[model samples]
Target: MSDYEISNVDPNQELAEQGSDNFWLIAAIGLGLTTIGIGIKDFFTSRKLKQEREKNKLYQEVLKKHQAQINELKNEKERREYRDRLWAENSN
Candidate 1:
């Protein structure tokens, strides 16, 4: 047709340009995310470890406080007796 013949744009050129632009954009975004992840990877790992340790420390503290209460129970019951025995073994 006259329109196709008169047009300055080539169909292949337009397709190639679009594909190259999308590829570069995706590649750049992927590279940026990878770099950011690498840079902060250690920070997230250390923070997770720190949180775990704090959780363990709090758990131990709770047990220690509960043991003190169990030791104070004047009337011995099955539950109290069992807790006290476990406490005695772990205290040393």
Candidate 2:
């Protein structure tokens, strides 16, 4: 029997196994964080878009009501102007 004979076990194999396990653990943690970050970003973005759409709808309704009032006022002004013109012509 010699000092370095008949041993098939490798110390490097244990190191390789440990390295592989660490690599897998790091990969899983990275994937989990990426998924969580995307979910949070999407939730906030969706909420902000919904709020903006609601605000725009309210503004559109206000604009429609204001336009209707302006049209009515314009019609009244035109009627008054026509009456004034007829009165002036009759006087002349």
Instruction: List the candidates' TM-scores in order.
Output: 0.40, 0.82
Off by over 4 Å in 1: 1-5, 45-92
lDDT for residue 76 in candidate 1, whole number 0-100: 62
Best by TM-score: 2
How good is model 2 by TM-score? 0.82
Tens-digit lDDT string for candidate 1 (3-38)? 868596676987999999999999999999999998
Please, what are the lDDT tens digits per residue for candidate 2 over residues 10-89?
A: 87999999999999999999999999999999999999999999999999999999999999999999999999999999
After superposition, the stretches of candidate 2 with alpha carbons farther than 4 Å from their true spots are 1-6
Candidate 2's C-alpha lDDT?
A: 0.97
- Candidate closest to the true structure, highest lDDT: 2
Residue 52 of candidate 2: its Cα lDDT?
Answer: 100
- Give the Cα lDDT of each candidate: 0.90, 0.97
